[model samples]
Target: MRSAVVVPETPVKSLFAYPLLLSLLVGGPALAQTATRDPAQIQAGTYAVDPGHTQVGWRVSHFGFSHYSGGFSGVSGTLDLDPKNPAAAKLSIRIPVGSVSTTSAKLTGELKGEQWLDEAKYPEMTFVSTKVEPVGADKAKVTGDLTLHGVTKPVTLDVTLVGAGVNPLNKKVTVGFEATGVLKRSAYGVKTYVPLIGDDLQLTIDGAFERRD
Candidate 1:
């Protein structure tokens, strides 16, 4: 028999590294499965929204010459998802209206004030889906009631499933989606500048949710 080679153990940097390492080891198999897993195989259940990973942005025409964009900072929600029966999936999201931010602090304040979003009076905006219509394998049209600026209106979003997999750091099954829609701010009673600032606003949503045990 050949002589046995001896190996030295490398010490882990910190106590925090233990869970991280374990997560990678345990999550490896799941991560691999994600690539070949069909959408129909996605676990059906309620997933808790990962607030830190969610974003909602809005773009509007600035003076008929260019487009400007801004976004809200805080978002929370639950996604009731069923992969086999995609039409059964539903979404409920809450947006803190006061979290609106742009390139300038002054503009941000103005947006929350009466002339724009009037967030002082309406502190939050929300969307609750009434129906989800699958368009293709990984896309859908989600219709819902959007409550913004104290006005409620029906809005439909073209949504696409971005990806789904086990997060190696957290070891949780995560799903991500992107959505886009348009809303007329004037219909929501925020017609400040009208044609000058643009009445129609484009909304974009990017969010991820982790499966809840």
Candidate 2:
């Protein structure tokens, strides 16, 4: 037999590196199967209200009577979307509290007062998202903090992504969605009347934001 050649073996060879490498390779495809995992792949867009098409409307119980509804005229927002990673997303909206209309100036003033929106003191109501959780292929839950009547509270919205595609006007990708949530006005220090105008306020928003240029 030829002279044996001795070779030093590494006792601490990395088995750990192999799986990590494999995971990096296969993990992407696997995670993609459920939702997007690429944050950088997501797009950011700004949406201006058509004013004609968009609306911010709310309804509340009227002394245990029929549901009374009213809408706001000025509404605007922007959307941050990550198609490759749905979890990494955010949305924000702002509306003028004084824009509430009820077909009566007296009612409008009342809405602006402390009994309702208290618009003179708090001119605007805003919602800023904290986290995004995809509900499915096209639905999500947006957890955010909403400041209304100068009171800030955490709120969650059930969101349905209407669609995302190209826009001819701006020549950019656009996304549309509808979200709804309900909150007790009193919870946000909006407490004033209980059964007269009702405490449960239902919020509905129809928004469309386009990719920024």
Candidate 3:
């Protein structure tokens, strides 16, 4: 009789198998709606963007003119997903470009005019994260298309888990994350050549999402 042969598993197979096993153990129950407890809800909860607590700002040089700094106000959004399967997530953010403030009224108006934002035509900008990749325990990379001035472009953001806990009022477990990214102004069609403004505009986004009740 010939001896039975056992095939050796490859490292990639083992790595993928580990997640499957883990899902079978942890995610299985979390995913099983009828079999398990009610899946958590991600809407119907109070989520403050914490303008004083958060930041969505950008900087650009003026023809070597000078450094200009400004940030967004009235930030808002909703985060929906399975904490167990964070990749199954969705987010939305809206910003008013008209509200942008600069050190000078002249600069602010210039930024909002056709030479830059063209606020008359594109008054608002938005972003909705389409994909989320887990970096570690509470860190992730959020990838999505950002729309600005009638143009949409794919962008990647690095996110950090700020904190998560149960909200007393809403009675929902909430998770917080801070996401950041940067982009060139010209890429989004914001091209206003000036003696002072630099083409390389630095965009910084800090997003903190809360799980809904």
Candidate 4:
């Protein structure tokens, strides 16, 4: 008798599987929720952005059906804090557009093309705080120039101090903050599919910095 023929089943894969897997591999562990504490009495100085601990995420309405989201890595920046005078605080952040990741590879490729971010021409985007307004002991309104898609626009973000303390493992003073803002892509000349893809996008930044001096 002829040997029975058999076929192997193929595994199903989602478009976002790779992105999810990459996020998991890069993200070490889930952060524990700490009790709300007053902002640390941080010394007046400059702090270096901890790239590994920084995450810049964005979400946009897609055809009014869902809010699709993605994130960018490779962040490098500095924070000049003025505890005595919070308004004198300054922040300079740089993000490489090429580091943007999405759920789909095709979408990512398109975003890097001329129709969208045009990453080749504008490889990096920056935000330099123009003003800082302290609203509370642990919250502030940060206004800055956000440059993207070869265009620059004024944007404001609501920032809150998460926590600040000495890191047990790194043995360094670390500060954490979370910020949220909204921007219209069309204003920045990224009007690919305006209404359909969504013109307004929400941005959230969770960052950790180590004191340099």
Candidate 5:
């Protein structure tokens, strides 16, 4: 006698299961509420710099061979903003010169030495905005007094609003920006290499500020 064979049952699949998993992995709805670039969404008040997320990057030509890059962290600052009057916005930031870093340990250490940044003499670099001119819907020209290596010079940063919204993890109102500018190292008394390492330093700043008010 042949025994009856039992058929294995096929498991049912929920149509919503795959989409739910994908949404969570790719940050669907949660990401939408966290950030926005619309200037109208920004709240008017004071915002303190989120140092952990802010950085000032520098790049310069290396003996006409390649461009070398480095960055300075441990930034602190504040932003006083009014969406209705972006031209009147105020900005002030301080960056620890000793925080400068590069891929090469020796190069990084040399940058902090007397002939370079002279971090011992100038512990910090500072910028205070003297004028904020709105150039576009989300762009501006921020002219500030940049003090580096004990010398102060007027530096204009072409700034753009990156985003403004509530930070998902910290639940704090946050705003971000990117700025680019160029300055001659000689102007700041950092003329060690001169034309060999490129006198002009290209600066790029990624700044994050959290609402304090």
Candidate 6:
């Protein structure tokens, strides 16, 4: 006669715990995904600008009564960065002049005409950084040549590192920055109405860059 074989049964609590533990292990990184402003976390490499996530905004005083604002899209750029040597960073940016948009349709059309930006003559505006001076752990002064409206001028942008991290959706390393500068419209030969439309233009750039590899 042969004895009956017996099988050990799994504990009820362990059965529920197994799947829960597996889920935590698999989703831990996604659950903890976040961008940080720490300069030490910046990765050293070449990054291409994320045009869909970058924008350039400009504001000017309208007849000294109120501020008028507009923005440019379709921005493209590249950045070579080294966290250990921030000063050695290089940047290049391109902006399509025709992408300028404002609240009013008529005003937007006028901005693209010969009287204002004259996009027909100068189809693109570009900036190439000449120097990068770190001011703080996450701040820098970037001096570059800004070519706009058929003219080029030296402009200094106060740039702040906003965040650096791996993008959740694409899993690519990404960095973000905010830059501000003031430029005289007349200096770039975009002067249609000097004092009337405000000669000084306040520029704010929101840039996002993703690592190439």
Instruction: Give the candidate number with the greatest TM-score.
Output: 5
RMSD (CA, Å), candidate 2 to true, equals 19.0
Candidates by TM-score, descending order: 5, 6, 1, 4, 2, 3
Please give the CA lDDT of all the candidate structures: 0.88, 0.75, 0.69, 0.89, 0.93, 0.94
Tens digit of lDDT per residue, candidate 5, span 1-213?
Answer: 999999987445653558776688678765446789999889999999999999899999999999999999999989999999998899999999999999999999999999999999899999999999998889999999999999999999999999999998888999999999999999888988789999999999999999995
Task: Name the candidate that leads on lDDT.
Answer: 6
Q: 1 or 3: which has the higher TM-score?
A: 1
lDDT per residue (tens digit) for residues 1-213 in model 1: 899989976677664568767677677433344522357756778998898999999999999999999998679989999888899998999999998999999899999899888877999999999999999898999999999988999999999888887877778888989999999999999999899998889999998888999
Show the lowest summed lDDT stretch of 10 residues, model 5.
8-17
Give the range of the ten consecutive residues with the poorest summed lDDT in model 6.
25-34
Model 2 clashing residue pairs (backbone)? 36-84
**Higher-TM-score candidate of 3 and 4:** 4
Indicate whether candidate 4 or candidate 5 has the larger lDDT: 5
Q: How displaced is residue 202 in candidate 2, in Å?
A: 0.5
Per-candidate RMSD vs. true structure? 6.4, 19.0, 16.1, 10.3, 6.0, 10.1
Query: Could you tell me the lDDT of residue 20 within candidate 5?
Result: 70
Lowest summed lDDT window (length 10), candidate 4: 28-37
Score every model by TM-score. 0.83, 0.73, 0.67, 0.82, 0.86, 0.85
Model 2, 121-158: lDDT tens digits are 89999999999988877778999999988889999999
Residue 19 displacement (Å), model 1 = 16
Any runs in candidate 1 off by more than 4 Å, and if so which? 1-37
Candidate 4 lDDT at 162 equals 87
The residue ranges of model 5 lying beyond 4 angstroms of the native Cα positions read 1-33
Expressed as tens digits, the lDDT of each residue in 1-213 for candidate 3 is: 999999986687676768867677664644321111122333334454534344578887855757778876666666666666778767777888887886788978887899889989998888888899888766779898899999999888887765555544444455556677777777888776743467665667665544433
User: How many clashes (backbone atoms < 3 Å, residues ≥3 apart in a chain or on different chains) does model 3 have?
Assistant: 10
